[model samples]
Target: MAEGDGVVKSAGRVLGLLQVFAEHRRPMRVSEIAQAMGIPQSSTSMLLKTLTAMGYVSFDAEAKAFRPTLRVALLGAWLNEEFATEGSVDEMMVEMARATADAVILAVENGVWSEYIHVVQSEQDLRYALRPGTKRPLPATNLGRVLLAAKPDDEIERIVRRINAEAAAGDRRFDVATTLDAVHAIRRDGYSFAHNLISSGASVIALPMPVPPGYKPMAIGIGGPTDRLERGQEMILAEMRRLLSQYLGG
Candidate 1:
C-alpha cells in the first residue's frame, strides 16, 4: 500500500479502537480488545500505549485493562455545541421529545452508517426504544436517508454499493434500487419517512438539521410504532420543522 493510504488506514483503526471503548463502555484487557477487533496483540498493545501517552485512554494497572478517558467525550462536545444557541444538545432533545411525543434522536453519518449521538425515549408505552450511539447502515431507515440525501448522487451510489455488498456477504437482503429511490425522494422532499424498515412495527421520520456553515450535516428524528407514527406523520413533520426553526433559526 502507498504510504499515504497506509497512514489513513492506521488512523481509521485508531478511531475504531476508541469507538470500541465508547460502545462497550468499560475497561478491557489488551487481549480482549485485540480479539474483538481482530488486531494482533502486539499491535494493539502498542496502539494502546500510544493512546495512553496522548491522554485519550487511561490504563488501569490494577485490572490490567485500558479505558477511554474524559478526553474522548470532550472531542464531540464542541460539535454538539455548534448546533445549539446555548450549546446544550440535551435541551434540543428534550424539546423534540416533548413535541413529538415519541423517541427523539440526533444522528449523523459515520462512513456509510448512521450513528445516533443522542436519544430521548418516548413517554408512551408503545414506542420504539433506540439507545444512543446505535450505528446502522444508512439505507436501513429514514433517520439515515435524510443525511444521505444531502450527498452527491455519485457518492450516494458508492455508499449504497458498499453497503449492499456487505449485506450480501452476511446473507442479508437489501434492495439497492429501492434505497436509491428513497434517497431521491428524500432529496426532493427535504425529509424522510420509513415504516417497519428498521424493526418490526416501528417507523421513523427524520429531517436534516441546520448547522453552522462548515459543520457536518446532522439529523433529528422521531420514532414510534407504525400505527401511531403513520397516523401522526403530518403533525410530526410540522412540529419538527417548527422546532428546528425555533431553536436553530433554520
Candidate 2:
C-alpha cells in the first residue's frame, strides 16, 4: 500500500481503539479492546500505547487497563463546530435569554440525552439544577425530546429500544413504545411544551434550533414554573426561528 494508505489504516486503528472506550466510561485492557474491535492483541497493545503517548489514552495503574483521557475523548465529535458557526450562536442564546426572562439554554444531543452547553438563569426561585456537562434523559425533558424528534426513524427506534432496555434493567422509567410516540409527536408539533410531566411543578418548553452548515445543531429552551412561559411559547419560538435564520443565512 501507498504511504497515504498506511496513514489512513493507522488512523482507523487509532479510532477503533478510541471507540472501545466509548461503550461506557470505564477503562479496558488490551485483550478486551482486541476482542471488542476484532483487532489482534499485539496490535491493540501497541496502538493503545501510541494513543497514550499522544495524550488520548491512559494506562490506569490501579485499574490495570487503558482508558481514554478527557483530552483523548474531547472532540470525540466529527469535528469542531466552533469554527463552523463563527460564534454567532452565543449571541442568539443571549437574545433568547433576554426575551424570555425564563431560563434559556443551549444544548445538544448526547447519546439518548441532552447536554447543556450554556444556560441562562431564570428569575424565579425555582429552577432546574443543570450544569454545562449534565446529562438528562430524552423522555424527561423538553430539550432532550426535541433533539430526538430531529433524528431519523431508525435512530429514534434505536434510542427508544435502549431506553426500554435500561428501564428493564431498572436504570430508567419508561417503555420504548411510549417514548417513540412522544418523539413523533414532538416532531409533528415542531416544538414541545409540558408542565410537571417529569418533575413536580416544573415546566419546560424547548424548540430545536438550526445552525450553520458544518455545525452541530442546538435547541433553545424557556423553563420555569408552569405559568411563567406558558404565555410566551409562540413568541419564543418565533424569535428562535428568526435568530436561526439570521445565523445560518449570513
- Return the TM-score for each candidate structure: 0.67, 0.59
The per-candidate count of clashes, in order, stands at 0, 0
Which tens-of-lDDT digit does each residue in 73-100 have in candidate 1?
8887886666666536666677878987
* True-vs-predicted CA distance for residue 145, candidate 2, Å: 1.1
| 1-250 per-residue lDDT for model 2 (tens digits) | 1114346878777765654564333788778888877878998888888878988788888878988887953563333253224334555666766766767777887777787766666655666644454577776778887887777867877877776676644566756677678778887888878677666776778887765456565676777777656777677777767666665442
Best by TM-score: 1
What C-alpha lDDT values do all the predictions have?
0.81, 0.69
TM-score of model 1 vs. true structure? 0.67
Model 1 RMSD vs true structure: 6.5
Candidate 1, position 37, lDDT:
67
Model 2 misplaced regions, further than 4 Å:
1-87, 124-129, 167-170, 213-217
Worst 10 residues of 1 by lDDT: 1-10
Model 1 residue pairs with clashes: none
Q: What is the lDDT of candidate 1?
A: 0.81
